[model samples]
Target: MNLLKKVTALLLSLAIVIGSIFVGTKTNSYAATSKSYIKELKIGKTYYYNLDGGKYKDKIKVYVSKNDNLLLRINDKTIKVLKYDYEYSKHNYNRLPYKCNVRIYNFNKKDKSLEIVLNYREDLQEGYRILKFKNSKCLLDKIYNDSYMEKYDSNTGAITLSEGNWGLFKDFTDAIGRFGCYYKIQIKGYKIYNPYTSNTTEDARKFKYTADKNLNAYTNTNSSKIAFTVKRDEKVNIYSFYQKGNKKYIKVKNSSGKYGYIKIGSSPLFEEWLMVR
Candidate 1:
């Protein structure tokens, strides 16, 4: 009886050990399954499409939930619902009506890397389409004028010739007379600010130009003879004009009034610079 009791107790202990191991394995598997393969995207995160390998063809909005489901909205339509499964190294899904011909990526917040692959079909015959967003925000770099001559005084940070000399010219001809009686100025390194500011107010702004009808070309300062014509509705960097030592020269200006000179006679002034605002 004594031996039998000892054997019975040994079996019970062995059984408990085996059961504990089994339970641990199951718990681990369940935990792994609960994790999601796709990384969570924050609010306002966007995915851009590659149309011709040079520009963004389209964009998609990513909405992440606490339950690990990813919601994809394209052109205001909810097109995809992905389940987050963490056990696998990669997660992939396919659906129909892939009009944008772009891939969806899981935006990883930790390393700022996209982890998932999103593929779509496209038609080459159609030219690249521009992505439209109703209330989305985009990042824009600040542009500065590099070609103008910058001078720093004790009171002012950097003052260009155009900003200081524009007042010197009583009229448009007076400004032109300083530049050998020519009606054009060359500008370079025009910086485009993301959120534009003015002397009176700060607001969203883009680059713009106003030129006389005779001077319609627009180009970066380095390029020869205005590479393109300025459109009335197009956004442009403001090129500041100033005079140096009683001579008139064109310069690109920053918001701070710092200016850079552009080549003379390279492009004609379409109108008096006054109309550019």
Candidate 2:
């Protein structure tokens, strides 16, 4: 009977130890999974809370549940319970309505950084609606026209153009339209000179001049000292020009395919300094 009692006690002890180990493992696993969700969040990028169990690095299937909460960190500061009680499915995780407000700083300059804040709720039934924060405006705006251009001046921080006139623009838009065709600047009457040739004028003749592929050119007079050529009948956008003494240098391209700044003149074929809108 004593032996039997001893065996029973050992079994009970083992069971208790196993239970404690199981509980500890479960807690650790939960912490690990939760930590993964909050890792590598950019300061100003918005992220939705996903309740489904999945990895965070890639697109993960998530299912929303009422008990799920999102942990957020901004500017190295921990923010707990930014979003709560959100439910989602793996396929429709992004459709769920818990959203954070993200702002991009210095987007015009080279140093672009993000700042994010949680100030909105996602309503799946009603689509996404932005909840305006105190003194904050909505980020997204509707398109007013089919073709539009907006220009901002860095010098004065003033918006100059909503549409019309490329000359008023400081920078060119990189997007292409459906037609896949646009305008460019064309240059004429520019002379190419070679500094190395003994007969400078004659040597200039020897260097076969060609237009650049993009139908643009740079000037030899600038600090860059780069000469670009352009092909004939090709279009290019014109920016600023360089001027020295009595000569004004305009950026252009040649018929043979080269791009750079060229001197403009009244030659019949190379008559007009033209820019396509």
Candidate 3:
């Protein structure tokens, strides 16, 4: 279950790379995009201001819910996007006022547009977004950024969206105030590449791995001491161990070699992201 949350969060981060990452043999299209009267700027300067987004991507940021303003400044005015308790036109989910955020950073001299990423959620459900500045205004072209979806539901005292498809915006379009999926992305002058790199040593690689699934491996037959747990698959080492009652136990070691124990048969290898160097 936790694995679902981790994977969904990951998928949301990679959301912006959708066209460039997943198109495979097909023609990769762009993510969510927005267009407004271009905001002119002066050379050799930077600006900062709070961001306010409305509906999907394109719409007035001012005079709207200003709860979750992550701050986006272009030139002199703040780019109001990334709104919490925001309403959607095309989204039909179980939660209301979906919690979403998009932060702009890493100014690229080559492209001249700010790098943007988003993470959206409803309670624990997942979603994400991406944006690119065109030296003037913001536009939603692509959507994919799993990094932002990692939020903790303080009320529940657990990782929010810890498990689910995060099928937030399954029907995003360029239409104003209407988006299909929350992973909707918008980019301008971005490098596209194969998300996966071909490496002959991949299969043979082994190192620290994140706990993709919830697991507990104990120490002795009495199980008095807990060896380690692969919870959330936080990179670990398959240390050493023995068996009890025809059942095998695995000694778990952290990157520091601190060890623990758990059952040998945990989540399948497919569920765990094989720590690759």
Give per-residue CA lDDT, model 1, range 175-262, as digits (tens).
2221111111211112111111111001111222333332333244444555344343232333334334433434434333433433
Question: TM-score of each candidate?
Answer: 0.19, 0.19, 0.28
Give the Cα RMSD of candidate 2.
28.5
Q: Model 1: how large is the Cα RMSD against the reference? A: 31.3
Local error of candidate 3 at residue 2 (angstroms): 27
Of 2 and 3, the candidate ranking higher by lDDT: 3
**lDDT per residue (tens digit) for residues 106-223 in model 3:** 3233344344545555553444454555434665435433212223222222211111212321111111011111111112244421111111011111223355556665555456
The TM-score of predicted model 2 comes to 0.19
Over 25-94, each residue of candidate 2 has an lDDT whose tens digit, in order, gives: 2122122221111333443354443212123212211122346644443222323344455333222465
| Cα error, candidate 3, residue 34 (Å) | 24
lDDT of 1 at 219: 47
- Residue 30, candidate 2: Cα error in Å is 46
TM-score of 1: 0.19
RMSD of each: 31.3, 28.5, 18.8
